[model samples]
Target chain A: MTGQSTVLAADVPFPPSVEDFYLPSIVPWGGHDSYWFTKITALLWISVALIIIFFLVTYRKPKLVPTKKQWIAESIYGFVRNNIAVDMLGKRGINFAPYLTTLFVFILIMNFWAIVPFAQISPNSHIAFPAVLAVISYVMFIYIGMKHHGGLKYFKHALIPPAPWFILPLLIPIEFFSTFIVRPFSLAVRLFANMFAGHMLLLVFTLGGFAMLNANVWFAPFSVVSWAMTIALTFLEFLVICLQAYVFTVLTASYVQGALADEH
Target chain B: MGMTAVAYLIAGMLVWGGIGLLVDHWVGTKGIFAGIGAVVGIGGGVYLIVRRLGA
Candidate 1:
């Protein structure tokens, strides 16, 4: 929140800087050292709570004709169910609709938090959170393949593509890393980098604009331009946030599809 | 083979190449081991992609 970072007195040689924007405190309240209760942790829980509350309110009672709440809920569910899971996995994907929907919405909210006023940072900007999400997707992708095919068959299918035995030494490690390790690593990095970069961009403009305003009368116009850029970037960030969420959901579904397929 | 396969290839080379560099550091053999690891990684990655996706 720029509250602590805004203090910049000329008396002190070390004034507020941009790195201060990312509140990397181990503990929120001054207490024991802990990873718990960080801003990102709160954001993650808020996202989960919002999703649960959304569905809970929407489907509390059975209705022949749906209300606005039901309509919104159904639309979200339908989009993931039909557009993502169904499209990727066909009839077999029906069982995965709920999981995909949860994933899409969770990511959407986490990303959306960056642009939200007062809550300017996104939890996904941190690697740890994205890493966990990626691990979940990675495990599921591998697990589905393993379940569909036997364990031995699944690894064979994943590791050994239709290639000559002579190339095995070259192919095996690449396949192992790319197919198994890369999936989760890339997923986490992609999300973390986007969110991290977005937050930094916003911080620069917002803080630069403020710094300019406080510095001199001649710099006021440039301050206005900085603020304008910040506003414009907010809209672009909104689109990106939604898009990233959709991309994550779609890729997850496709991974499942790949896993379930008879062969690559 | 696919974007995913390509990603795998890059990841493979990066990871193995990194390990090779680490080993080189341990052995103090300059970039020799890293070069070997990188070449093997490229071949393996390409082979993996080709086998699964073909061509």
Candidate 2:
């Protein structure tokens, strides 16, 4: 038991760090110097390819009597359209349904990788991916507002609320901070933080199990418990993946709805 | 809707408290302005929420 525990201890690195998020470079064959490509990149590309191919193949020929594949594809689109877009934006929701559906699907797949075998890290755990998505949503809502309200009047409408003249100064800055600054920052940070935390939790539990097993014979029971917790947390991670994806899509739709609303 | 309300509350505090901190720096006050700023900011946040999110 002593000898086996020692070997196991050496195999498992206890207490994961930020460095674990940075996987070894795949291109140039595991070279440390270059991160030209990594598992994260592969997961992202695979997600994109899978989504595109799935939609294209499923919808290549429109059928009045939908097949299973078509039903699944249509269900995904219809769910976003009816549940998120239309619910949030009303009549104009159909116009934005495609983009919102794409966003929801992409985020769901990217986050799902955290619980997936082999590819155990989600690209969204990295802030860069979520930040980019947030920027797109930010720019979109502003653009829609400007177009709907006509020119700089959009800023006027968004910033100047239906309040009296005396309190305008205080309210304006608050509105600016909340609307302009907070919206995108929160959007990106929310998604990035959720995925990042989810991955870190799984790593801690999984590695902690091995660490315990390596520590001593008596700790073997605790090791099994830790592994069980890891399995349970994976199921929990699946829930977060779906939720964050839905929340991101819904918030984006809500922002667009905010932008498109007429003056009261 | 929940997130938006949170953002508004946080934004109000941040915007006002930040302004207060700057005022404290300029006036050489001992955190009084900062405290005042936060309260005022939060008050404005509640008002904004009522106007924007209230039915």
lDDT: which candidate is best?
Answer: 2
| DockQ for candidate 2, C-alpha atoms | 0.92
lDDT of each: 0.80, 0.94
> Model 2 in CAPRI terms: which quality?
high
lDDT over C-alpha atoms for residue B28 of model 2: 99
DockQ of 1: 0.59
Q: RMSD for all candidates, in order, please.
A: 4.3, 1.1
**Compared to the true structure, candidate 1 yields what TM-score?**
0.83
lDDT of 1 by residue, A130-200 (tens): 88989999999999999999887999887776767886666666667777877888788888888888888
iRMSD, all candidates: 2.2, 0.5
Q: What is candidate 2's TM-score for chain B alone?
A: 0.97
* lDDT of candidate 1 over B1-55, digit per residue (tens): 2567778678768867987999999999999989988877766666655656664
Residues A1-264, candidate 2: write the lDDT tens digits.
578667876876879999999999899778989997999999999999999999999999979999999999999999999999999899899999999999999999999999999999999999999999999999999999999999999999999999999999999999999999889999999999999999999999999988888766788779889989999999999999999999999999999999999987
Candidate 2 deviant stretches above 4 angstroms: A2-5
